[model samples]
Target: MELSRRIKSLPRYLFAELDRKKQALRQQGRELIDLSIGDPDLPTPQGIIDKMSEEIRDPRNHRYPDYEGLLEFREAVASWYWRRFGVSLDPSTEVMALIGSKEGIAHLPLAFVDPGDYVFVPDPGYPVYRASTILSGGIPYTLPLREERGFLPDLRDVPSEVAARAKVLFLNYPNNPTGATATREFFREAVAFAREYDLIVCHDAAYSELYFESPPPSFLSVEGAKDVGVEFHSLSKTFRMTGWRIGFVVGNAAVLSGLGRVKTNVDSGVFNAIQRTSIWVLQGNMDGEVEGWRQELRRRRDVMVEGLRSLGFKVEPPKATFYLWLKVPEGYTSRDFAERLLEAGVVVTPGVGFGEWGEGYVRMALTVTEGQLREALRRLREVKL
Candidate 1:
């Protein structure tokens, strides 16, 4: 059978070749220090696990969950947003559950974009933004995030004609490949732009809770943002709940209604047990536990940043997130630099894998331990660029 046209139009998997090489090395008994993906190495807090254990045994939870999520979970989210961001949310009207932020982000284009419509998406962004737009038969209009601009997209750069047809604008901060954060002023600007173009603003704030310095502001916290967009957040990064597959979207009740409609038809809601456990995590007195994670992550970040800088690699210690975006050594492309690291039995994501504008940089995740980072540093020192 032939693949559908949309499936065939998807971009090639850039890491497939790198993955094959890794497997070959593994077969040869070579040890590799992989620092590619941004999965947290920390375990889900014991409190969350214990809470889930209790919820899973409830007979009622075995039934399919409410499509909009349990009212209690949504209330907890509303409360948490108020406490953490000073942002008030109407649980019944504005908040809805997601299997994960990725699921919601992937389905959003389906609800708003028509064939050949434009979606203003950040380049070097989470691949889901571009992939989902394409899958929905929408054109992805690139919003280039260059280093000179602190990696924030310049909204004014979009042609007026392109903006006129754009149906959505996707943003992420602290960003994925680049560890850049956006200011409230920038978010205000985004809101105005969305209003002018009549676009749905999709803000992926999955990394907001993983900050090292000041807490990152939510797009919804900006005045009038709720008039134009919604923000997607996940328990994955903050609670080490990546495998739990639970998250939520808030703001613009009308936009959330569209996403909820798509979700109801496409798949069942998040498991009730998981949702209840997430509520426990959100409502519990767990600030100390989360602070502990931040401490560990900060230590790991320092070790990696210091080690890379000593080796003459141009990298900044990110103020948020566990990723370090490094400029590849001169005369070598991002793929070449990553491949060289692989030869040294170390793995880093080539920035080009994110998008065309990501070339000349490599992303290193701090999910590995300090000891592994030290060992990787030693290996990196021997690689000739």
Candidate 2:
């Protein structure tokens, strides 16, 4: 049996590879302290859960839901965007529900990118961005995101030829792997670049609500961003609803419609009960919930930063997202360092898992309890990286 050429070219998924190693270690009776994935250990708010429970009992909700989503949920997302970012959207056309932001990010290329068309992807980006592009038979132009440039790819640095064939550009901030957040000015420039190049901009704002000091900026906040851009938002990070698989894509009507068409062919819709719960999560004033999570994350961030520093590693407390992007110590690759940490009972993601440019660093997610975090730090300090 022959496999598809496109599928053959793709690398094994980062987390899947990590899971294989983790499971092997765990099977050996090693108590693995997993900090590799960015999954929140916090519980979902009770209000949202209660709403889901009530909706689940309704016989009507058991039927197939609309592919676009429930009108109430769409309207709630629109209203949330308007109130949170002051970006007005037409719920009827500009908003489409997704199983999760990852679904949208992975399936979107099928809607807009033709085979052989070029996509500008960050070198140290979330792997799905590049994998999706490859799976669609589209060429991915990796723009190296270097520390000197604040982990952002400079559009001006893109070669003229690559820019000419580029149809889509992917941006994420409060970035994964490297928790670098983009400023409004940078986003404005990106919007302008997309407009000038006649490219579609896909902004993955999954970590928008996980900020520490200032709220992360939405792509829609920039002037005319909606003209050439679509942004993906997820309830996973914001409302601790990772398992719910609810998220939204907001922007140009044409792009939303195209994505909706792709979705209709592949998936029916997210569960109605999840949609109703999402409506409650978005519309209600969950200020207390947000504040509580932020404070706890802040304390964890300080401890991890200080602990890593004491081990003679340079680590900056990320301004947003619960990840620590630490540079690999001398003479060790990111993969090797990660393996060493795992052997010492700590599980962290290797930078090389994200991209080649990410090879010199490692990402540690602060998704464990304070005591567990301290214990991981102690074990890390003993490891000879």
Candidate 3:
């Protein structure tokens, strides 16, 4: 059998490679404390589970779902967007339910890009952005996010010629692996940048609801943002519903329609029962419940950041998300540090797996219990830099 050229373009997924290393250590009977992935370790809200269980019994939800989604679910999404980020959306044309934000984020490139088109992606970013661009046969241009720029891409450095050929630009705030957040002013600047380039912006706001101190601002909260972009929201992190696969997109109606067109031909929509439960959670006033989750995350953040700092790693505590981005110790490359730790029964993601520029760093996810995190830190102490 022959493989497709598109399938050949992607590198091995960063997490999958890390998992292989983890499994090898497990075979040796090592007790491991893993912090390699950002999957939440918390339980889903009981109310959401009850709602889904109840809806599943109804025969109306047994058939294939609407291509767009259940109408009520779409309306709840618009209402939630307005209440959460002050971004008003039109339910009928501007919103579309996704199996998850990742599904929409990956498929969107296929809908808008041509084989020769350019796609702008942040280096040291989530692997899906670059892989999806490659799968769509689009040329990917790397935009470096240095610490001096607060880990945000500089619009001034983006060449006008590249922008002219680019079909889409991806930005993620309350970012994964890096744990960085973007400001409203930054989003406003992005809106102007996308407008000047005559291209679409794809903001991956998956971690928007997982902030520690303040809620992260949405790209759509900026004035004129709807003129050029759309934001992908996920229930995976926010609701700890990673396995449920329910999410939605809000912003530029035309771009969403294009993504919807692609989705309609590729697969079925989210299960109707899942959509109904998501709608219930959205409409129920979940502010206090979500904030409680953030409080728990904040406590975990303090423990990990302080423990690392005590061991002499110069890392700033992240204001949002549940990941820590740390520089590798002196004389050790990212992979060497990770490999050393893996042998000590602690697993982490080596940064170079994200990109060439990520070579000197490593990412630690705070998904483990405090006791486990402390155990991992103790294991690092044994490495002694």
lDDT of 3 at 276: 90
User: Model 2, range 1-385, lDDT digits (tens) per residue?
Assistant: 9999999889766567556788998999989788887889989878777888998998878889998999999999999999889999999999999999999999999998899999988978888899999988899899899998988889999887788899999999989978899988999999888888899999999998888888988998999899998999999988888988989999989989988889999999998988887887888656579778888898999999998888888777898998989998889988888888988999988898889999989889999988899999999878975
Between candidates 2 and 3, name the one with more favorable lDDT.
Answer: 2
Whole-model lDDT per candidate: 0.93, 0.89, 0.88
Number of clashing pairs, model 3? 0
Q: Estimate candidate 1's alpha-carbon lDDT, on a 0 to 1 scale.
A: 0.93
Quick one: ranking by lDDT, best first?
1, 2, 3
In candidate 1, what are the lDDT values of residues 1-385, reduced to their tens digit? 9999999998889988889998999999999999997898878889888888999999989999988999999999999999999999999999999999999999999999999899988989899999999999999999999999999999988899999999999999999989999999999999999999898999999999889999999999999999999999999999889999999999999999999889989989999999988888999556778889889889988998888889987788898888999999889999988989998999999999999999999999989888999999999989876
Model 3, residue 301: what's the lDDT? 85
Which candidate has the highest TM-score of all? 1
Mark the regions of model 2 whose C-alpha exceeds 4 Å error after superposition.
Answer: 13-21
Best candidate (score: lDDT): 1
Supply the TM-score for candidate 1.
0.99
State candidate 3's TM-score. Answer: 0.97
Where does candidate 3 stray beyond 4 Å?
13-21
